[model samples]
Target chain A: MEYAYYPGCTLKQSAFPLDRQSRKVLRALGHGLTEIRDWNCCGATSASKLDDFLEVAMPARNIGIAESAGFEEMLIPCSACYSKTVVAKTRMNRDPRLKQEINSELAHQVRGEIRVSSILEPLFDAARSRELGQRVSRQLSGVVAACYYGCMLTRFPLDVDLRDDAENPGFMEAVLEAAGGTSLDWQEKTFCCGASATVYDRETALDLMGRIFSDALARGANCLVTLCPVCQMNMDAYQEAYCSRLGRSRRLPVLFITELVGLALGLGYKELYLDRHFVDPAPLLREMERQQETEAAS
Target chain B: MQEQTAFQVSGDAARELSAEIAGRSEQPIASCYQCRRCAAGCPVGEATGYLTPDRLIRMVLLGDRKMALNNDLVWRCLSCYTCGTRCPNGIHTSRVTETLKQMAREERLEPLHPKTDSFHRSFVKTSLFWGRMNEVGLMAAYQARVLWSCLKRRDFREMRSEISSQTRFGLSLFRLGRLHPGWTVSRGRRELGRLAAKSGRHSR
Candidate 1:
C-alpha cells in the first residue's frame, strides 16, 4: 500500500495537523506515502479564476512530476489541492490539444497516465478493510461527529467520481463509523464555509460558519470533522468570532478526519497534534479516554 | 416592490457576446430559460441582494455585457459549485462566473470588490515568486493593501482591530510551527517560472 502524497501548500504551513495526522494514520495502517518531490502550489481558486492556462499548467506540472517519478496513484490530502489537481487532469485528458499545449509549456511532459485521488479514497478503503476493526484500540462510540466535506471533495460528481452523493456525502461518515464513532446527520455537511472569502468578506464568512456550527449543534453533534484545511480554519479559528457576533457561548471542537482516525487507532495526543487546533480538542480526547477506561473496566 | 425595467439587448452585441461565450465555454447559454434553480441553490445568491446565479446567466443570454462584466458578483463568487451541481439546465454558474472574471481582467475592468482583486493578484504574484505560496509574505502584502484602503475610507479603528486580531492569531500559529516568516522555495521553481511565463504569453 504505497502512494505518492501531495500535501499542497496549506498542509506545510497552516494545516500541519492534517499533514502530521495523515502521515501518522497512513503509517499506522501499513501504508507508505512518499511526498511528491518538489511540488508547487496547485494554483487553487485564484489562478483558475484569473488565468485558464496557468491554472491547468500549474497542476499539470505537478502531475507530470508524479508521472515522471513512475507513481501510478497520487493521493492528495487537502481537498482544494485534490479538486484543482483532479480538475486539471480531467480537463487535460479530455482535450488533447490543450494537453499538448500545456505539456509543451512544462519542462516535463505530462503523460496523463497517473491517477489523481483524494486521501479519503485510500482512508475509506482502509476503513473498509477487515484489519481496521481489529486495529481500533479505542472505540469512539460516545463521540458524535459531524463530517464536513466542504466544497472541493465532491463538488463535481462525474469529474471527481466521489463514492457518495456530492450533495450529501457519506464516505467520511462511513470511515468514522468503521473507527467506532457515530457520525451525525447534519444539513450543513456539504455547505460552503465561504473559503478565501473569509479573508475579504468577514461578515459573510462568519455568517456562513455560524449557520454550519448551529446546524451541527442542532443535530446533537459533539464536534465537527473536516477534510479541507480552509474549512477547519474557518470553523475552528473563527468559531469564537462567529459565536460572539451571534451572542452565543457554545463552542464545538473541529478536528481533521486524520486526527480523529489517529485517535481511534490509539495514537498519542501529541503525535496527533491535538493541541494545535484553534478550538482545543483536548477536553474531547480526555472524555473519550475516560470512556474507554470505563468500558474496559466494565 | 420597485418597478422592474425591461432590458433591451442590441442585436449585434447580443450575437457577438453569445458567440464569444459559446466559443470559450462550449456550453450553450441560450439553453438557459431563466429557471432560477441555480439561484435557489447558490449560497452567495442567497446571501447577497444582487448577482444571483440565475440573473448572471440571464444577463449573459440577454447580451448585457457591461452589466455582466461590471457586476460585483463576478468577483464575490466563492466558486463552490453548488449552483453548478444543482442547475437544472446543466449550466455551471461558477464556470460562467470564471469566464466573466477572466474577461473582466483582460478588459482591465475595475472590480467592485477591490480587496478580492488584490488578494488574487497577490496570490499569483507570490506563487510566481516562490513557486509556492509564501503565507507570511501574502499576509503582509494583503494587510498592507487592505490597511491602505481602510485608511482612505477613514476606517482607522476597523483597520487597527483587524491587524491586532490577525497578528494574535498568527502568533499562535507561529508558536505551533504552522507558520513561518521565511520562504521555502521549491526545487522546481525554475521550471514553474518557465511554465508560468509561457502560460502568461499564451493568454495574452
Candidate 2:
C-alpha cells in the first residue's frame, strides 16, 4: 500500500522523530510512503487567522501537486496539516467559484478528486487486516498508554470524517490494543493542549498541559501516546515546567503512536528515536523491557 | 444592585458584523438561542473575560461592534473548535472568532493580548518569506517586535526578562537541532511566492 505522504513543517524540524518513526513503522508493516513533491507549509491556524485567501490557497497548492503527481490519496501525519488540507479541499470542491479562484492562484490545477487521509487511517486498516499483529515481535503487555487526540484530528466531523465519534474517539485505543498495549480510559483524551499558545501565552498553555498530565497520571497511565506533533511537544517538553509549577514531582513520558508501534515491532530504542524526547522515555522503556524479560522467563 | 441599562441600536456596525460573519461561516447568528452550551464546552471561555462564545454571538446580534472588536478574547481564542463542534445551532464560534480577528486587524484595533498577536504575525511573515516555518527566524522576529514595544512603553525590565526567558527555551531547542538560524528553503519556493503574492492581491 503506497501513498503520497505530506509531512508538514513541524515534522521536518521540531517533530523530526515523528517523521522517522512513522516511515520506519509503515515500512515494517509492508507499506510504502512517497512524499508529495515540492510541498509547502499547510498554512496552519496562523494563516487562516490572518487571511482567508491564504488559508485556502496554501493547502490547495499541495493538493494540486498531489493530484498532478498521479495520486488519488495523500497521507498526512500531522493532525493540523490533515485538518487544514481536508478543510481546504472540502471548501474548494464544494464551491466552483472558490475552486476556480484558488486554482488561478496556484501553478497547478486542483482536480478535486484526490482524498487526504491521516497516517492513523492506514495503520488502523493494517490492524483490521491482522498485518500489524503478525509483524509485532514484542508485545507491549505491561505498558499502559493514554491515547491523546488533540483537536484537529477529529474536530470537524462533517469535513474530515476521520473518526466515528469525534468527541470520544476510540481509533487510537484500537490501534494501541492491536500493538498489545493496554489503552487507559481517560476523560482528557480529546482535550485541548492550547497548541501554539505554548509559545505566546506560556502560563495558560502550561496550565492546560498540566491538567492533561495530571489526568493521565491519575488514571494509571504509565505514558501518553499521541498522533499529533503539537500535542506531543506540549505534553513532553513542558512536563517539567508543569510539574514544578504545580509542586508535583511525577513525570510522564509522551510518545508518538508510531514510536510506540515501532517498539512493539521489536524496533530498537535508537531506531525509534526515543532518546530525543524532551522528557526522557528511557526509564519507562527499560522498565517495560525488564518486565518483558521476567515474564518470558516465567 | 442591578441597574436596567438599554443599549441603543448603533447604526450598521453590529448588523454589518453579523452579515459578514454569516457570509464567511455560512451559519446564522440569529439561530443562537443563548443556550450557553458553546460556552460550557469552551476551554478558554472562562479564562477569557467577557467574551464567552454565547456572549460573542449575542454581542454580534446586538450590533455591538466596538465591544466585540475591542475585547482581548478575540485574539486569545485557541481555535480548538470544541465550542463550534458542540453548538446546537451548528454555529462555529471558532470560525466567528477567526473572522473577528481578521476584522480587528483590518480595523486597526489594539490587541488585548499583544504577545499572541505578535506571534501570529511572525508565523505568517516567516511562512511568506521562507516558504516554510523558520523557527529561529520567527523567534528572532517576535523578540524584536516585543523589544520594540517594550522600549516604546519604557518598560526596560520587561524587555530584559522577556529576552532572557525566550533565549533559554531557544537555546534548548537549538541544542536539540529543532531550530536553525539560517533559512530552511523548500522546493517550489518561487512558485509559493507567486501564489502568496497573488493571494495577497485577492485578499486586499
Candidate 3:
C-alpha cells in the first residue's frame, strides 16, 4: 500500500535518520511511501501553542500538499509533527469554520479527505508488520529498551488516539518486539522530558531528565528508545547537565525507533542514523561489534 | 530546592479522589504495595517537592485527606501517566491526583502552592466569555482574581509574598511585546460547554 509521508522540518534536518530509516524499513516491508513534494513545516510546537489558526493551517497545508500529491493516508515520524498534523486533522473534521479558515490559507489548495498517522501506529499494524518482524535476522534478546513518549504525542485532545493507550502507551513494545529487543515493562514509558522548556529552563529540564533516566536505570534498561527528535536530543545531549546537577555522570544511549528497527533488520549501523546522535553510541557500538565477533568465532 | 514539607493525607479522600476524580480502577486501593515506582516515574513529581504518586497512594491507604489536598502535591502532576504505564495493578495514579485538584477547586480550598492556575483559568474564563483568549485581558483578569482573593482574606501581604521577584521578572517577559491578538479558547469553551451539557443530559 502507498502511504503519503510528511517529514516535518526536524526529520529533514537533525532527525534525518528517522526519515531515512523509516523509508528503508517501509520499503523492506513491501510498503510504498510517497512523500509530498512541496510540504512545509507543521509549525512544530511553537506555532500550535502560539495560535490556533496557524497550528491548524500550518499542518493542513501539508495535508493539502499531500492530497495534491495524490495520497490519502500520510505517515509522520516525528512525534511533534504527528501530534500537529493529527490534531489539525481532527480540528478540520470536527469544526467546519476552522476547516474553512485553514483551507483558505493554503497555496496549492486542498479541499479533500486526508488521514494522518504516526509511524508508531503503522509499525504496530499487525497485518503490515508481521512479516517484517519475521524477517529480523538479529535477536536483540539482551537489549533492554525503555520507550519514552514525550508530551504532544498523546496529550492534545484532538490527537488522542495515536497510541494503544494515550497515558500508558505500548507502541514502543510492539516496535521493539518487531526489532527483537526485550523491553522493560516499566512505568516511566510515557513520561515527558520537558520538551519545549529545555530551551529556556535548564534547571527544570535537567531535573526532569535525571528523574526519567534514573528510573530507567533502576529498571535495568540498557538504552532508551524514543520516536520524537526533541526527546532524543534531550536524553542524548543533556547528560552533562544531568551529571553536574545530580553529581553523577549517567550516560544512557537514546536511539530513534527507526534506527532500532533497522538494526533488527540486519542493516548496517551507519545506515541506521547512528552517527547523527549526540551521545556517541560508541559503547553500544562496541558492544554490537563484540557480539558480532563472538558470533563469527562460533 | 525548597525543603520538603511535612504533609498529612487522610486515607478516605485519597481513595475517594482516586475513585471519583483520577478515575482509578474500581478494584481496590489497598492493592498497592508502596513499590515507589510510581513516584520515581512521575515527571511532575521530579520537578516539584510536593508531589509523589507513591506517597499519594500511601495517604489514601492510610486515610490522609488533609495531606492529599493541602500540601499542593496534587497540582504538581503533569498527568503524563508514567506511573500508570508500569503500575502492576493498573491503578491510574495520575487521574487520582487530578480528581484531588478538581475537588480542591470546587471547595474553594486554597492551592497549596503558587502556580499558573490563575493565569490558565483567566485564559479559560475569557475564552468562555469571548470565544477567544486575549493575552492582555487574561493577565488583567488574573491580576483581578489575585486582588479579589487577597481582599477576601484581608491578607494582601501574603498575596504580595506569593508574587516573588523572580515571578515578576518572568511576567515582564510576556509584556515586552504583543504576542497573541486572540485565540480559539472562546470557541473551544463553547463547544466544550455544549458537550458537557449534552453529557449531563444523557446521564440524567
lDDT, each prediction: 0.82, 0.82, 0.64
Across A1-298, the per-residue lDDT of candidate 2 in tens digits comes to: 7788999888887888889888988898888889988788888888878777778777888999989989879999999999999988988887888889778766779988887899898889878888888889998877899999989988862355455488898888888889888999898888899999988888888888888888999999999999999999889878889899989897888999999899988899887878887888888888888888998999
TM-score of chain A of each: 0.97, 0.97, 0.91
Question: Can you write out model 1's per-residue Cα lDDT over B95-149, one digit (the tens) per residue?
Answer: 7777888888888887778788878777877876788887888877788888998
Off by over 4 Å in 2: B1-8, B11-13, B180-182, B201-204
Q: List candidate 1 segments past 4 Å from native.
A: B1-8, B149-162, B201-204
User: Candidate 3 residues B1-204, lDDT tens each?
Assistant: 335445455556555654653332232456788787777766666466545777777665655665665554465555455576567776667546645654565566767643334543554445335433344565567667766777788987856864553255334333422133333222233333343233221111
Which structure is stronger by DockQ: 1 or 3?
1
DockQ of 2: 0.58
Best by DockQ: 1
DockQ of 1: 0.61
**Which should have the higher lDDT, number 1 or number 3?**
1
- TM-score, candidate 1, is 0.95
A204: Cα error in model 1, Å: 0.8
Per-residue alpha-carbon lDDT of model 2 for B40-112, expressed as tens digits?
Answer: 8777765775568888888788887777665656777898988878888888878888778888788788877
DockQ of each: 0.61, 0.58, 0.06
